[model samples]
Target: MSLSEVTARMAKAADQAGRSMDDLSLIAVSKVQPNERVASVLDEGHRIFGENKVQEAAAKWPMFRETYENIELHLIGPLQTNKARQAMHLAQAIHTVDRLKLATTIARLAQELGSCPDLFVQVNTGEEPQKSGILPTEADEFIAEVRELDLPLVGLMCIPPVDEEPSLHFALLAKIAARNGLQGLSMGMSGDFERAIALGATHIRVGSAIFGERDYG
Candidate 1:
């Protein structure tokens, strides 16, 4: 899909949900995409983006950011304790903070660096054993813990069990955010972003559907 197609679809989704398009933010997930594809999006003037790894984003975004003014970058995948400092510098937002050690590190780095972009706590609503989010039952406690650390807590993010109804997971995430008084809901991806918007996803990440599938190698 093209950038226009994605934004048009996003607008339609927001309209259907009775929300303004201006209230929603679309993050082009450029995790594994090549620079050529990223440049294509840049050429189109889409300013927001998401990436999965700090190292990869560190390697790729400086040149892009230097070329394009006011581009907002989000780190939307698992974060490591060691990379917390780098992430605090590289991303305008961090969407996968899930544990005490990492969150602790991020809090420290945010203070030491004096730069704390928006932060989202990742919750494993599906309770998938292998996933990289905090357990659903632990979300409240986790949020409280992070708050005690004085990190810039902003919202919640979740990737549902791919087999189940995405709307269910999206709603669950919204509920969690509401319970905790968070305003941002970083749910949705290419497959179910429309549904995510209807259910209250303030931020949606789109990748392959726009950039095409990536080669892991």
Candidate 2:
């Protein structure tokens, strides 16, 4: 689908949910995509994007931001503590502040550098051991911990287990957000974002549906 089609669907879904498309944000996942393909999307005047790796984003986006106006970059992957500085440098939002240590690092770096991006706490709503987010049960305390660190905790994020129902996980994340008084949710993707929209997703990440698939090596 093209950006206009996706935006139209988002508009319809938001209307069905008693919300406006202006209340939603779209992030094009540009991980593993070539620079030319990213440029094509940029050429269409769509700016916000998500990248999974600090290294890859650091390698690519500086030049793009220099050339383009108002580009917003989000770090949407498991962030290593060592790369916290790089992520802070490149992204306008960090969507995987999943642990106390990482939160502490971000808080410290933000204090030192005088710039902090909006932070999202990732919840492992599916309780998948292989995943990087905090367990759902740990969310309240972790969010509190993040607050103690003085990081700008803006919302909750999750990637539900691929085989399970995504709506359940999205609802769980929303519930947790509501309980914590957060208003942002980065829970949907290219495949199930329409459902996510119905459930009040503030941000949805799309890649293949808009840019086509990349067989990442």
Query: Per-residue alpha-carbon lDDT of model 2 for 73-142, expressed as tens digits?
Result: 9999999999999899889999998888899899999999999999999999999989999998889999
lDDT of 1: 0.92
Worst 10 residues of 1 by lDDT: 106-115
Candidate 2: global Cα-lDDT? 0.93
- Residue-wise lDDT of candidate 1 within 1-217, one digit each (tens)? 8789999999999999999998899999998899999999999988899999999999999999889999999999898888888888888999998889988888778788887989999999999999999998989999999999988898999999989999999999999999999999999999999999999999999998888898799
- The ten-residue window of minimal lDDT in model 2 covers 208-217
For every candidate, C-alpha RMSD to the true structure in Å? 0.9, 0.8
- The residue ranges of model 1 lying beyond 4 angstroms of the native Cα positions read none
What residue pairs are clashing in model 2? Answer: none
Number of the top-ranking candidate, with TM-score as the measure? 2
